[model samples]
Target chain A: MPACPKCQGLIQETDAFCGHCGNPLAATDPDRREDVFDVLTPTLAYYFITLLLLGIYKLTSVFPEGFEGIIVITAIDVAIVIAFWGNYFQSLRPLFSLRGLSLKVMAFTIVGAMVGSVVVSVVAKWINLSIQDDVFYSTYMFQDTAYPFLFSTLFIAVQPAIFEEVAFRGFLFDNLLKVTPGKSTVYVTGFVFAIIHLNIISLLWLVPLGLALGFLRGRYNTLWYGMVAHFTYNFSLTVFEFLSWF
Target chain B: METSSVDSSAETLACENCQAVNSATQKFCSQCSFPIGGTKNEQIAFRSNIAVRTRMLKESERHVSICKKLLYFLAGINLLLGLYFGFAADDFPSMISSICVALLFLILTAWADRNPFGAILTAFIVYLTLNVVNIIDNPALLSRGIPSKIICTVLFVGGIRSARQVTLQREALEKLKAPGIGNR
Candidate 1:
């Protein structure tokens, strides 16, 4: 009649460790939680390697130019199109709970992003730092190429809304908790998530974003909270860029 | 280190809730079914497994992009050779060969439109064709080489960069669709 405390799976009263999750249940001790700093280094390093390999492959080819670059970049637009489909899967994915989504979570996500961005904006202002010169529009390529408003919208909004949420919130945050038991995982995972951006200049802003996303992930137990927040963050930038306000 | 020391002792001492004992090595509480310890190592092993599977998935998605790039590189080479023969041979046969290479390049481009790497190769072939055209116009076209070289450099570098992003995004999307297995 006992439920396995580890996974909430049904387990016989005679079992010591959870047969399903392998969690040690007999010991009257606190569960050992692996620090996020410990697990993060490898994951972040792997991410760097991924970026390096991708950059090398991208820079070496001879292809899109003039109007062609637009076409090729539009190929990236394919990701946003798929992001639309991800919405459907989000509801159906059993592991991800949608029930936690409430008005409070939505408000928290927006407030978190806004607060994070404002802090970042202030820090950059304090340091007299400039926005990354050639990041969005790379210098070597896409110089004359205009990233159209629509494409930019897709790039900023849907792409990060889906991908970053899935990676930082849904995957990393969830997985880290298995090692580092307890609610404190939200903080540890947040720090690691910020580090993965690998842009120190934006670290101040990114850290809060990480914290907010992690909070939402834990609070709602749903990936949608993070996704919605990420979308809002990106969409704000898009609006700022559109208005030439930044 | 101190925290872990404190944690282990606390677990051994705390008896707020009673659960059936399984064994010293056993991880689960027999009656209450609560995990007692050693969750970190287990999660690491599980995540490592996930990482390996994700790597395999990524490699599979990259297969198409790798093929397209190689094809593009080959098309560029063929187009260049055909152009060289056209000028050196100075005959109708040479011109026909050049035209044939150009036609082949076009076919490759059409095929590549749906593929990222193919598009890049097609662009290179076009850039080379421009050079071939210039050479045909001036048999001794050494002076115009500098300008042609610049165009080729831009086309080649820019095309690949664009294609790579496109392919990466495609792969990311594909990965997101595939459900995480073994978690259940």
Candidate 2:
């Protein structure tokens, strides 16, 4: 006896509809999803809300100018994520688990991220001869009366390390796993991560870094590994920026 | 060509329309679902359902094509606007900025041509983000290009609706393409 593809109710070989479910024997495909959007509707919706809010703030001039602005915006981001996070909590919960955490691989991830950050920055600067990144840093990053470096570490490194890993590695990567092969999942999520940052110049290095982060999450089955790696990478760059490497 | 006079008592049956064979217990033909073993009324109902679905697929495809043109128009407008600004203001960076944006739209347009549902949504998100950056960077900029901006936003919203239509149509078509699942 075969089964209905959609309802899974057993049916006789010659039956057009399942005996129990009466569903037409048509629609026998197991999974109907064909495109990236097919699998990523929910995840994209969550991402869209955040981006839309940011745009709304800019257009309205309601967003503040400095640290207060950053805090408020970050707060809204967190709230938006939390709102969406409730629905996906069950699906995303596994990413937070710490099973199979190997000390050796963790150590390598941290070291590799640190070393890779230097190469990325240097190569990025080389690729664009006049990499006027100072404008970007001055415009968006830790501005203020004092403790700019500390704020830089917090905002630039720690925040993205923890939060971004949750979004891209946690939500987006996991969503891709169902539709794509394992390695493709890493590559696709990496590409998406880089593009979302909206910096065309930074895409050269950001893409690889996104791939690295995706690899860590998928391999370890936990976001902790990726978070630590992301923090190390971003923190090293933060330190380098203060040291005037650019 | 439909031969719905399938014999219920026979061990094997052949489809009335396509002539594909099926088991007597099967109410629909295996290859074409021609109601090889069903009564006259059942066969009519099955075909009516299929006809309705086929009509929907055709409608959705038409809608997707219209939305795709909107994306192409957006790309051309961005290229023209960016070049105008770059030349008028004599700022290379500003010029590069719009050119890059134009390129992104062109790429997105191509992607939409292939996969309208997912690709168009991606474009819609990026389009909004760019405008947000523009408004934040210079509030005056929004006031400067009111008509074009409004038109672009309308196109994006329309494109998104068309993408939803594509999503629904593709799902229905997939069922027919699946093995052992002839037209519903």
Candidate 3:
């Protein structure tokens, strides 16, 4: 005797239907097919939203000047993501979990950020010289300000560190990891992060920085370390700009 | 001897379709004429056949979904380009045609999500026909139409593959719903 594939009822060897449930046992066997949509839906949703926002920013003349624009855009981005993926946020709670941060981890994050800042600065200097173009900073906005140092540091460094880390390393990277293979997840997320910036000149540096941040997020299984690194990178540049070192 | 005879008769095959009992030696049910078997080997073979067909149907559905998603992305791109060309281009006829084709692709994309085989086939035919007419009207479009033709070719092949799988799955389902077999 054979068991029915659907109702699990025992039937004669040549029987096509289940005796108990009257189900077509041969046709109703379980389908174990895996669809990528399970992963693609959220990932694509995030990217599509981001692209749509970028398009709006390009086309519209409604945005405010200077740091206000950045704040408005970041706020909108956060709001859109929260609204779009409200249900999924609960599952992503682990990525944002700050409970496990130890003294050792804190020290590592600080030291790593400092070291990464120096290395990136050196590389950026060389690239800037080779390309014969400025490092594409928005320091011009602060040039005529009452507090150039404070404003630039706040706008260029802290804002991106908090908002971008939450968006890219925290949300986008985690969602991408679900769909992508373990080895390629970091690289793919990094590429997307760099591309989203839409700066060909800064791409050379942004790509590696994105990769480093992605690596930190994956290795430590948290977003704080990447945020610290990002802040350090941007803060270091701001400090140099204030001191006129570059 | 009586107990042993009763136990032997209890081993008689039952019809899955009609629940009619038949003797162990019978090849088919007496009440419903449904097929029945006695050997363990036949039971295993039947189970394996069902498993294989089920797996094939699932795999086909997955492929169709993946292809449909790709087509949706392409359609979106086409729509954007059509909008840009429609508003900005000086060539009135070409711009209108481009917008119409893009709208058609968008409809096909939505349709593909539901009926991939039919939608893909229709898109393939429409694209091919349009390209042929354009080329006959103005041979200059040969250069411009190459990409469209290639895309249609790919869509046509994908549609054929999806259609074949859908047909196979439908046939299997029909077999399950035949006179003696119940619907799953």
Candidate 4:
């Protein structure tokens, strides 16, 4: 009749190991209410590495000029995308389903991304103005090119759209479902997504952008909508980023 | 990190939580670290203890990260100021050194996640060394940014404290892994 204190699995006095969980049965300590952290380690490690890489990328300015720099940056993003699908191939395969995806959802999500980007742009401008820092925007490889819009959209909008969705909505959000209940999972994923961007100044818009992407992925149960939204958002900002140079 | 689904079978092992099913050859769930076949309460308790330690380590990580962000901002400012002054005199040494220092801070910020205490301690030493060198060059240098300098010093000191906590938490977690841990 005595229960194992550890996992609450039933154990007979004669059995040394718990039949349910296989834990060794022990006497003495009363069962205390237990809590759970509710995450698998690999996912946590991925997020941690992502933050470190993004932070280092932000602070270090030693990349070769122009398009070469874009190649270097995008290489890391591509590798991360590979890792996301490689490590969790079976788990992430489900997010690729088009069950709830529709033209209306894609259109709505794209509109949301555009509106979100504008809000972010305005908030970013306000922050720059208020801080009086002039907020150096590094054009990097996107500068002085014959095809600034092409390079920016390819390197910035398209690449990040695919990569970020896979990393966050596909890998992280799916994994988070194992830990958290349905309601808060999206926002939690969004919060983590925002933090990884490493731009405190744009957090006002970044958080919203993150939430919108999370919502798209969560609502429709597909990465395509989120990808469309993400691409739209970044592409819109790419326009804004290049607007002043001309 | 690899997770594969297994159809329910007599030969397969199951995890209590996380829903991870493992082959009979596996002793723990690869995805969740849950023990397989048979587990002891002590193992669960041990993982729980480790989870707590991991949380503590993350809080410390947040501290060093803030310190890292502060370094980022200061390094940018230093690089800009160095270029400005160096350009006025056409002296490239200060500019080169400033860039080197900025790069060093960036590397330290990346390393901070892995070893918060060591990275922050090294960063603190470098920061203090820079301030001392500047003060020696011109005693009046201290007067210009006293408030800002004080804030940086306080934040660095707090970062160091958090790094120490990280070390302690890590050690405790390591001890929990020693042989006879779950046996006890």
Model 4: per-residue Cα lDDT over A214-233, one tens digit each? 88777778889888888897
Residue B105 lDDT, candidate 4, scale 0-100: 71
Compose the digit string of candidate 1's lDDT tens values, residues A82-152. 44335445533643566646887688778876665555545665767543321232222323446656656
Q: Identify the leading candidate in terms of DockQ.
A: 2
> Which CAPRI category fits model 2?
incorrect
Model 4's CAPRI class is: incorrect
Q: For candidate 2, lDDT tens digit of each residue in B59-154?
A: 767766776787787788778888888778777776776787778778767866656655565566667667766766676776787897787666
Residue range A1-246, candidate 2, lDDT tens digits? 577676675455655444333355654442343554566677767666766665555446577866777678778877766676676689888877777788999999989998888787788677764333621223134655478888877777777787778888877777767644567567656766776665766766787888888888777789998899988988887777777786
RMSD vs true structure, all candidates: 19.2, 6.2, 13.3, 14.3
Model 2 bad stretches (over 4 Å): A1-22, A25-49, A52-76, A100-116, A127-152, A171-200, A207-225, A242-246, B1-10, B16-21, B29-34, B140-158, B164-168, B177-184
**Could you give candidate 2's fraction of true interface contacts?**
0.07
Which of the two, 2 or 3, has more DockQ? Answer: 2
In DockQ, how does model 3 score against the reference complex? 0.04
- The candidates' DockQ values read 0.08, 0.16, 0.04, 0.04
TM-score of chain A of each: 0.61, 0.75, 0.72, 0.75
After TM-score superposition, the amount by which residue A204's alpha carbon in candidate 2 deviates from its true location, in angstroms, is 4.1
Task: Output the lDDT of residue B50, model 4.
Answer: 63
DockQ of 1: 0.08
Candidate 3 Cα misplacement greater than 4 A, ranges: A1-34, A55-65, A84-87, A129-137, B1-184
